[model samples]
Target: MRKCLSALLAALAFIPGCAPEGTGDLDVQWTVGLTGSCAQANLGFVAARLETLSGTLLARRDAPCDAHAVRFRDLPVGSYRVRLSAFDGDGVEAYAATVSDLSVQEGIEAASCLARLTPRPGTISLSWYFQGGRLCSAYGVEDVLLSLFSADIEILAQSFRCDRGAAVLEGLLPGSYEVRLDAVDAWGVPSHSFAAGNLLLRPGHELSFDAELTPCQGPCW
Candidate 1:
């Protein structure tokens, strides 16, 4: 069965082209496979865009999730970039991936141009340190609570028990956020709080910061 299928595919790849003789036919055929968590999410649809290196749009397609793949056929042999975006039921972009510098050659099908989509989200890596004072003496900071707030100070996401003086907050949408860090003592009492404002996060990027919590004479909130 495998040998027969392989022979059939080889024969189909040589369909005659409109181009005159001596010019030869180097038509490109490509396929994008959906893998990883994005595939497991069972998104409603997957969209793709093909563009030239100079940013000129070449082609676009939208395929149903059940198709399990997207195929582009009869393309001119050239260098191009293909970007894939997967959308959920609510039409929100859930995952994205890009395959660039694709060089389509004669008699060679670009069937392995697989785009492994990852969840469309940003991450925050923070390193926290405690400065000296009476607050440090009275309390042994055991864990840290990191909170992400919107422009209006509404809580968007929070991470707890961020230990080892370092933590990573993942799966955040692209936007501006305000971060609040609170130190929790061994007794579970909040000791000090620090605020970092106006952090911009974008997809496929990691935002990092180093926070130093100083001793406060009065309440830090």
Candidate 2:
């Protein structure tokens, strides 16, 4: 019993945020370098820092003296930070920061722009970070019930767990619907909810929505 309980606790630690194998990879590696003239500049060198939106620092390295590169790898799919800096004899720090949205694909050598994630027809997918901050999955979240309502706030379908974070809400009357998501987090705690969009669910086609979550607050109401 003790061994079983320990195993259960280990699994719980990896809930919602960590998806199982075969889901996909979110690893990316790229180089950052300095351009233009470095000599005329106040400092002879620059530095770089890669971080997540949650303020997690992924990697950091010194900027190349010339047109050089810094490589970053194994980043999760989502948002991140890129900071640049230079130093002088005074030891006073100077830096710049930028945000980057990254998507990882297996065997792809280069990064694509964020505009590419738009959903297409036939296999509508809706994804979000669940209770424990893990990706919602087919095996785990496929069992929760769903109820879609129209833009008029009228009920459409009653409720059923749409497998694989992608639902084919078939037999529709052809109109827009307000999408709401309710689920449990990685820890099996009831999820905080969200709306996909004021979406136009067209007939005979698939619609995809990436419904991410935000911290619950009275202001959200």
Candidate 3:
């Protein structure tokens, strides 16, 4: 019957619409900052990726570390997140950076110029509480302020929920630093605090510790 044949033709024509057509390219560039040059940092290769805003992988390409750049061809036209990662000879990821809201248009090359990639992140997992047998929740503690200092200069700071029990920080540069913790209340005030010296972090590594905060009593800002 002609009607059945026509229906089959119509279904065949609609099949291509199921997938996005590739009509774009991307050029991603970066410098190794947290550890200096690729050779100095012992990086051997780099990998680039284009992902959707929701973190869906679209395309990936690998290049020599020193290339300092990678191009992605035949990408779909849409907003994407660009990520560049570098690895050492031992296959450990040593540096990385991500740029979001990068728009890839049809038939033109889009450039992402992130000045430098950070050294492979080191992680610090902290389990915290007050010294005088007080749990974070029982004492009206709302947030925990964890900060890192090198040579008495503040390096990084992050806030975690008090009741979260434990928090992991994966944004530290490889170095020895001091660690500080503050138990803060609903009014952005610290009522208990603790500090320790000689916290060491290394690239592609993790450190874990417990913190006991003594009552600051007053003016513990």
Candidate 4:
């Protein structure tokens, strides 16, 4: 799903006192970059991480998407960075930002800000046809199942009517994927198949795949 945009500007501030010995406290507030709200962009939550200046992770948490301020209490005094990421309903990152060079002092409150996250994700549109025709009647096929594989693991599976011939997948991570298509007959038997390997997906772009499915000879017969 493609969404519209709204700019969210984050702010940074620091206050003195109210911390335990040899430690500090942190508070973070942020909002989604695009659309009216996170819900409008189909984003559920924000992934927040506290890390050292040298890339050592300190603490991480998931915050609400509604611009709620999250509290990180009792942090060791040090210099660190804060990273924020918001994900879509399917756990795909839809918004992200990294803020660095934060210095936390003992017995003080560190307030942080974040840069605007660009809404960037990929989409895949697939269309399939049988050797005989586009109608799928000649092959007795009633359904086509589409499965997407990432790193040799099945990430998604969806079924569509054979006659439909096309479907669109959205909010995909940028990477290499394998697309598998199976045509099933009236009795739920697989009658034809097609596969395309190493399909590349880029950020903020749409990839299209059109393929012809051959009859399952020895296996189906």
lDDT of 4 by residue, 1-221 (tens): 01111011011113334322377677777765644477776778888888876688888988777764576787765556788887777777767778776655576556455456556778999889877679898888899988999998999999999998899999898779999888998888898999889998854567997889998766742
Give the candidate number with the greatest lDDT.
3
lDDT of each residue in 1-221, candidate 3, tens digit only: 53454344434545776433456777888788856588887888888887876799988889997888888777665567888888877787877889877755566556445647777778888787776564677787999898888989997888988887677877777888888888889998888888899988766667899888888867877
Tens-digit lDDT string for candidate 2 (1-221): 53454345345446885532221233222222242334433344446566664567877777543433454554433344555554433443322334354433234464432111111222234565554555446324433334567655747433434335445555454456777665544544433457665677532345666665544554433
Looking at model 4, residue 77 earns an lDDT score of 56
TM-score of each: 0.46, 0.33, 0.52, 0.49
Q: Top model by TM-score, which number?
A: 3
Runs of candidate 2 with Cα error greater than 4 angstroms are 1-35, 112-221
Error in Å for residue 150 of model 2: 60
Candidate 3 versus the native: TM-score? 0.52
Candidate 1 runs further than 4 Å off: 1-71, 74-119, 132-139, 156-159
**Model with the higher TM-score, candidate 1 or 3:** 3
Native-vs-model 4 lDDT? 0.75
How well is each residue in 1-221 modelled by candidate 1, as lDDT tens digits? 54454344334446675322221122222222333443456477778887775678878888875564665666654456787787876677666777766654445444446556666787888887766542344456766777778776766555455346677888777678888888877776677777888898754467999888665557755
How many clashes (backbone atoms < 3 Å, residues ≥3 apart in a chain or on different chains) does model 4 have? Answer: 1
**Once all C-alphas are superposed, what RMSD does model 1 give against the true structure?**
11.9
RMSD of each: 11.9, 22.0, 10.1, 14.0
